[model samples]
Target: MAELKRKVLTLSSGKQIRLYGNSVAISRSLEIGEGYAPNILSGNNEQPGNTSAGVINPYKLTPDELMELADFNIQLWMDLKANIRRFGVSSPRIFTGESGKQPTETTGNKKTGLSSRQQATE
Candidate 1:
């Protein structure tokens, strides 16, 4: 059997935790339901508003709803990744943008952790 992918995260309290990438857990928890696709909130106004006055806005998540969804998703992802030893926390943002390096765009092997571009360059 192939070994599961793993990651180590350091908490704000100076404690470290290990997480595993479990395929089954991730699929079960993170899979989107049928006919429901949540759009990522973006700054670009691609869909221009109607110029005429009195146009009702379409359905959208309120600020609270957006925050709740974001927090839920982040927590769900962490739980799925660390299925074997669950670590529940709402502070996944600690890893966000902390590293100055730009995120790699290339797809990587989940088992080997080697990106296609990295393999090609090697």
Candidate 2:
């Protein structure tokens, strides 16, 4: 079985907690498989007024500030990639009909630990 490399995460309380191997990773199958559209929370177009959540630049900074904002984003992504070594991918249960295709009646969406279906098997 694949495993996620352990890493430490610093909480806002100044406490460091190790993210265990059981920590769930992003699902590439459900995210970009045969039939999947990116969700609203997908951080794609992230400009001044092009955020996915809503249009609200609370700082009201000038365009020059965008460089600083981008720098922060780069640092965050770099850190994440460096620490995270493994990623979980979901293989959803799709009930097919005679036509060989059907809408997903039960997809294996899950948080961390054993998946909903995996738990059932256990």
Candidate 3:
């Protein structure tokens, strides 16, 4: 197999994590799903809480601090997801449409532009 390109993400604590393309990302996600499936199948339906993930907040944070923490968590998750190649825009070739084009008003008089009621009548 060909070598996959990697992007290194540097954390706030000076830790670095390597990000990879779709192949590894998909595999990792699927592995997580598979691990969760067994617990769900056996009726261990407890949520995977932050404590389970080994994150413990040692301080009694204020509301503002909690909000900041939540924002940081959300942003980090988004950054990770965005960096995973398959989860993001895979290619530039998939054009949505021509930009700055305005929609034109259509009359129901023509075959292609007929309204549902007009078409049904025909």
TM-score of predicted model 3?
A: 0.24
- Which stretches in model 2 have alpha-carbon errors above 4 Å? 1-58, 86-122
- Give the lowest summed-lDDT range of ten residues in model 1: 93-102
TM-score of 1: 0.28
* Tens-digit per-residue lDDT, 42-95, candidate 1: 333334784544422245658898789668767765644553343234433222
- Residue pairs with colliding backbones in model 1 are none
Candidate 3 per-residue lDDT, tens place, 1-122, comes to 23433455455666755654222221211211111123111222345643443323446566788789667646544544544553445533221223312223333656578875667777
What TM-score does candidate 2 get on C-alpha atoms? 0.23
Backbone clashes in model 3, listed as residue pairs: none
* Candidate 2 lDDT, 1-122, residue by residue in tens: 23323455455666655554323332222221121233312234655775465434555656678678657546544434433432212323322243334335335645646656666777
Candidate 3: list runs displaced more than 4 Å. 1-58, 86-122
Model 1 regions more than 4 Å off: 1-28, 31-57, 84-122
Q: Candidate 2 has which clashing residue pairs, if any?
A: none
- TM-score for all predictions? 0.28, 0.23, 0.24
